[model samples]
Target: MVDLASLPPQLRRAVDDEMRRLRAGDGVLYGDMTSEEAHDLESADGRALPPDGALDRFIAHATVPPADVAASDLAGYTLVGVVPEGPGLDGPWSSVKRVYRRPDGVLVMLHEWAYVAEGGGVLGVRELMNASVRHGTARCPAQFAIRRAPTGQTVSELRWFTDAKVFTLSVAQDVLADGGKDHGKAWMLRLAEAIE
Candidate 1:
């Protein structure tokens, strides 16, 4: 398991700061929804949310999985989030609500979120996969990947690949960086063990 205690001071601080920022104010940010609410939404809407909403839901949502649900249980499902958009190392892109999921559900989060310059898109599949390996939530397996556009520009495309299922995440400018920072890898590792 990854060690939060072992995290570099800067990375630890960055994650804490981001979490604090996300939790600030009236509305919760990531993982903020109650199971009932999520269940209801899923039943009514038929899919996960975009990053913006997902973050809030993630924050608010119960960290403990339902009695019957396990990390492996999500293998074939798609999760989506609406991420807030923001400036990138380069330029900017339209604020997007992205989707992530694995049709086979073998993968937990087919497309985890990452940040780039304002206009940066996916650069290379390998780079994205590496990012996921480095930055993805501990409880979830790396499912999504980012790549720079072929134009050789900073613009990127955050893409999801699964056995089949598709989920979505909505994002905003503020939270884009939060997704990338290596929060306490230790904490993440613990969370992963708990969930798995």
Candidate 2:
């Protein structure tokens, strides 16, 4: 077994933090068992282990599912929410959105803004217009795709980029697929009203 103590300080710290988080019920730890091992275990007693028992053991090992799985598989535990506008690199007020794998799963966040003209000049207008033409349509300017550990289903969210300001939105898989679509469309319409 790899000696945790022999790892670099940063790696050790990260491992420690991850262990703590997992123990706190914020996440699950699963072991990396090969297909052969799984088959052997399943065939050992001529009967399969209960589903919950298998899940519990897998969680204990801290196993991460393969990356190829789509996020849609873990929809039951996925969540989404909007982050409030806040200060930014240039100044105050920016919008951001966050997606959670499980209620406590790692959060994936996205930020976006409209392309604005810098000055009342033809060049500036042309540049801004070009950007708007490419990214400012009914389609969401910002989006997120997530695949939860252990189960590789994919969940996604799409949102309007709107103005150069910030806003946050959060939701779960069903909401993201259904309600979020409407919400994003509405946001796009509102943005068009403001700009056009």
| Candidate maximizing TM-score | 2
True-vs-predicted CA distance for residue 17, candidate 2, Å: 28
lDDT of 2: 0.31
Question: Per the 3 Å backbone cut-off, how many clashing residue pairs does candidate 2 have?
Answer: 27
lDDT of 2 by residue, 66-150 (tens): 1111323233434343232223332232222223344545332233332232211111111111112112344323322221222
lDDT of 1 by residue, 1-196 (tens): 2344465798667656645533322222332333553343333224545445554543343222111114532322454443323233121322323233445321122223223222234322221122122223322223221212223211112223222211222221122235535322232333223321
RMSD of each: 17.3, 20.8
Worst 10 residues of 2 by lDDT: 121-130
Give the runs in model 1 whose Cα sits over 4 Å from its true position: 24-168, 171-196
- The positional error of residue 109 in candidate 1, measured at the CA in angstroms, is 13
Per-structure clash totals for the candidates: 91, 27
What stretches of model 2 exceed 4 Å from their correct place? Answer: 1-85, 88-91, 96-146, 149-155, 163-170, 174-196
- The global C-alpha lDDT for each of the candidates, from Candidate 1 onward, is 0.31, 0.31
